[model samples]
Target: MPKSYLITGGAGFIGLTFTKMMLKETDAQITVLDNLTYASRPLEIEALKKNGRFRFIKGDIYEKEDIEKVFYQK
Candidate 1:
């Protein structure tokens, strides 16, 4: 089975770098949760939208409902 990843802060530099590394090295399904905070650059992540294994959510980790929505997503 393919691995599934929930990456917080994924629109930030290091996070985006690690996400790219994962994509290059493994067949993993990735979900990114970011609020487009000051440190985040949505444009960088936007390029990843073309990958079927990747998904992005515009949400804050501090929000309970947002976290629950990602967790329960089918």
Candidate 2:
């Protein structure tokens, strides 16, 4: 099976930095779920998207539907 990771609040500084580290160190598919309330780093996100293994999802973790959307990928 392929490796995958779901990172919450990844648009923020610490999370985004960690995401980049993961991208460099691991071959896992990294997905980020961030509400973008605290911070909105569109440029960084866009840069990360250039990588095929990186994905960004904008949604609140408190919402059940939003959480479901992450695992219910088609």
Candidate 3:
């Protein structure tokens, strides 16, 4: 079975690059959790949105409910 990874700050430069690399290197699914508040680009995230294994959540760390939803529901 393929593994799953949660990437915080995944919309930033380094994070986006790493996310791309991870997708290319593995068959595992990737969940990008970003608030989309600062230092993030919607276009970049959009590019990966079409991939079945890629998911993006526009939420902040301060939001416990949002964070919990992903972790617990998964």
Candidate 4:
């Protein structure tokens, strides 16, 4: 199976850039978790949803429930 990657703060510039590079360079399932903070790019994140291997989660990293969604999501 392909590797799965969980990218925190992925809507930020640096994180988003790295995420794109990973997507281009490797066949991996990428999940992005970000709270849509001021530095986040919601529109760009929305575009990432077009790729089948990509998923975006909007929630705070400080929240336990939000983090749980990563492992328990159906």
Candidate 1: give the clashing pairs.
none
Point to the candidate with the largest TM-score: 4
Q: Measured by TM-score, how close is model 3 to the native structure?
A: 0.90
Task: Between candidates 2 and 4, name the one with more favorable lDDT.
Answer: 4
TM-score versus the correct structure, for each prediction: 0.92, 0.90, 0.90, 0.96
Name model 4 segments beyond 4 Å from true: none
The residue-by-residue lDDT of candidate 4 on 8-62, one tens digit each, is: 9999999999999989899999999999999999989988899999988888889
What is candidate 3's lDDT per residue for 1-74, written digit by digit as tens? 99999999899998999999999999999999998867898899999998999988877777998798668765
- Ordered list by lDDT, greatest first: 4, 2, 1, 3
lDDT of each: 0.90, 0.91, 0.89, 0.92
lDDT per residue, candidate 1, 1-74, as tens digits?
99899999899999999999988899999999999889997888989989999989889899998898688876
* Per-residue lDDT of model 2, residues 1-74, tens digit only: 66999999999998999999999999999999998874768789989999999989889899998899899963
| Alpha-carbon deviation at 11 in model 4, angstroms | 0.1
Cα error, residue 36 of model 2, in Å, equals 1.2
Cα error, residue 56 of model 2, in Å, equals 0.6
The better candidate by TM-score, 2 or 3, is 2
Better of 1 and 4 by TM-score: 4
Provide the clashing-pair count of each candidate structure: 0, 0, 0, 0
Scored by lDDT, the top model is: 4
